[model samples]
Target: MAETLTAASSHGEHAHGEMSFWSKYVFSTDHKVVGLQYMFTGIFMGLIGGFMAYAFRMQLAFPGVEVPGYGLVSPVDYNALVTNHGTIMIFWVAMPVLVAAFGNYLIPLMVGADDMVFPRLNRLSYQVFLLSAIVLICSFFVEGGGFGGAWTAYPPLSAQSQYNLTPLGSSLWLVAVGLEFVAFLIGGINFITTAMNSRAPGMKAYDIPMIVWMIVVASIMFMASVGPLLAGAVMLFMDQNIGTAFFDPDRGGDPILWQHLFWFFGHPEVYVVLLPATGLVADIITVFSRKKLFAYRTVLYTVFATGVLSFTVWAHHQFVAGIDPRMAHVFTVTTLLISIPIAEMMFVYIATLYGGSITLTTPMLWALAFIAEFLIGGVTGVFLGASGADIYFHDTYFVLAHFHYTFFPIAIIGFYAGISFWFPKMFGKMMNETLGKIHFWGTVIPFNLIFIPLFVLGASGQHRRIYDFSHFPNLSAPWQQDLRILATSALLVMLAFQSVFLVNFVWSLWKGRKAGKNPWKSNTLEWTAESPPPHGNWSELPTVYRGPYEYGVPGRDSDYWPQNEPN
Candidate 1:
């Protein structure tokens, strides 16, 4: 191991070096530190999003009733909460933690490169993201509280200052989101370049870990898809400030154009967030199953297929938005067709588990739960994807429940699996497994408790985005009221459970048991480096000998074979 470290460091200017605190942490170009920075910031923003959800949930559960910590939420406040919560959770929280953080940290290490192809750009990415986040937070303090035009920031309402109500905050929200896109563009380019050019010797395209491949594919998809929306956002910004009529119907501009642009990016945007998660879950499933991943190439091909199909299906979101009726059929077919590749991937995962020596590790638990939860999400999506069913379900709590099912598994559960699986490698210590399992069950159960009832609410004809339900007798029925309270209580339970995870994460960072290299005995190149890999991951570049998953080989003395081992 020491020889391996020495050999790795002996190449080029890749030796582990010391630095001042500010240089090492504050403005460091080290991908690992930058990754952690992204993760912690994302976690903080997720909490804020959660609080926003809690406030709105309270309003839903007990209409007009003031909560203890926070006062009664006004309709304006509720709208702002809805808009900002969706924005923050998806962009600030999920994207940063899952994509930016993990992509920076893992791509080079798994591919056997010392650092990102553009290290300084990597640092710049985080800095710009931090700036965007700060700007968004500042938006909340502006004259009208915060942007209340919903997360989609749809036009007509979002375009015109008079209709939008929160002009200053909405303008800032556009700026913040646009800046976020720019930061990601920078980071996405880095991911593509590094993955394409930075692999160690013998690491071919097929040999790349599924997670790395997914990240690369997602970056490409994001780059390709985000352009129109970025243009739309800029146009919307113009509409907000300069009286441009880009999306304002009254000014002879078509509001539908913004819908086209936003959903063009929006639908694929879900896949952009999802692919990395699926990849992370893929890696974790194989690691704990102690088996080679079943159908690796097939899975990789599905990722490519999914990325391509994602662009075509974005119109599904515009189904109920008064697009050409004829076009709705085209989109409905595309939407349903997109599910086939995804279903294939899911089947492959289940097949991977068959006959494998599955270890019920905390990461494995999260991965399994992700599969189950995501299945529900996927199945429910069919209702929304079909133009006919969407008419009935549109703007209902069903839509909200469906997305949460999808995103929670991808963003929340998948992130937990990655964190639990990689905590040892990242921090050189083992997280408390007892607490981790507790957190997992605590989260999974309460999460379902919260969202499952929402499906019922949606079916009960309770429309979404309603500030107060007291006036609608059908929606305000006693039973519906009870269900809402149940969901809110479940949310509180989930929050309490999250505290356990927070404590575990911080406590484990400093005091947990030491983790030696390759603690999980996995085959990836990341484990070839030291736990908490040093600056410039390898002292000398290491070569990959085989694919990422080589577990449970027949006739081998050990159940797992590291990718770098001599054949």
Candidate 2:
């Protein structure tokens, strides 16, 4: 499997310095340590995002009643929760886990680098990300009880925070997110440079693993798109602090500019997270099915195509924001085109499964789920991409369902799938397979319960971000009743469902079965090393003779040929 040692174990890159626990572990620049930092931080953020959603879901399903977990919901607090929920889910939960954790861990090892091109820069990026998380967490206690206008922080509503609720923590909310984006921007730079120039002998640009391809393209996406949001964040800071009027209408600033900037990074940010999962799916799909990825060039081209198209589709989110009718049409056309490449990719996956031996491990289960979940999300997205349908669907719970379907499967479920599949390689042990199956079923049943009804709500015209909806009873139909019950029931089940996963994840750390390296007969470079891999990944650097996906090749010793093997 792995014949080549990474730079960490290479002749010149070894470290022998004595170190204290704090310096060696906490502040270390080792990509593995940094990766741990990202995982823990992302889990922490996930808890926050999860709870925030729980709180708001309570408000929506049982409006006007004091909920058990939350006390009598104040109107301002409800809005604040919604705002924080969106912010936390998008920035903290998805990006940190996807970009920071996986990127830090895999990029160096897979590319045969000892560490990132800028190791110290990697450490500093995580530090800043930590600080950003802290600052955002602290915003909850701000005098007015955090920003209440919603996560997008639209102007008029978000700009005059004092007017609607009180500037409260509204001003600081921008700072928290602004800092977070900076963290990713720095992280992206490190990823791009490391992959470009740092490969072992015989590893060409195309020879790199699919996961690395994902990291490269995603980093490029992050670099190109995040600037506008950052500029918007700075303007928002000025509008709130220096009274710069960038978003203040009275002072001749347009609120819509803030949205334009936001969805700009915002939409591409979805792919920034999705591409990695797609890469993981490609890897997992081929490995478990005992076949190569169906069309390697097609996968690469589609990924490249999607990254470029992600930028142009940002305005689809802005369709209902009172933008020009012509702009909506342009966005509609572009958004639809982006889906073509994705549909092509989806076809590749479905086609690859045609004649392969499919295994159903936890990782495989999650990968299959990723396909199902992402497809649902992708299909729903079509309605929202068209200008006519979007005008009706935008700002409604329908939009909420649409993205959750995509992001949950793509980002949350996608990451979960990767982590579970890689857990053996990551932690050096096999998880409880039976328990894992139970966890998967728990996740699947409740997830569909939670998001599917939101589509029904969208059809009925229930707008998102509404704190109190008792006034809307007059417009209700029988369908809304069924949906409200369904969504509420699903939310409860979903929360309870996480416990199964948590228990399996925690218990497996100490009690699970021991696994040999390459338990899945995977062909990628990572499997050539020891289970849980040493500080330096390989004993010696292995020369590459073929691409990473050499499954079912005739005359091989086994079902797959390792990437580092000689022909």
Best candidate (score: TM-score):
1
Over 65-93, each residue of candidate 1 has an lDDT whose tens digit, in order, gives: 99757798998898999999999999998
Give the C-alpha miss distance for residue 514 in model 1, angstroms: 0.4
Q: Rate the local accuracy (lDDT) of all candidates.
A: 0.91, 0.83
Clashes of each: 4, 9
Best by lDDT: 1
The global Cα lDDT (0 to 1) of model 1 is 0.91
Model 1 pairs whose backbones collide: 8-539, 8-540, 9-539, 9-540
Off by over 4 Å in 1: 1-17
By TM-score, how accurate is candidate 2? 0.96
Which pairs in model 2 have colliding backbones? Answer: 2-528, 3-542, 4-540, 4-541, 4-542, 5-540, 5-541, 8-114, 162-167
In candidate 2 the C-alpha lDDT for residue 447 amounts to 89
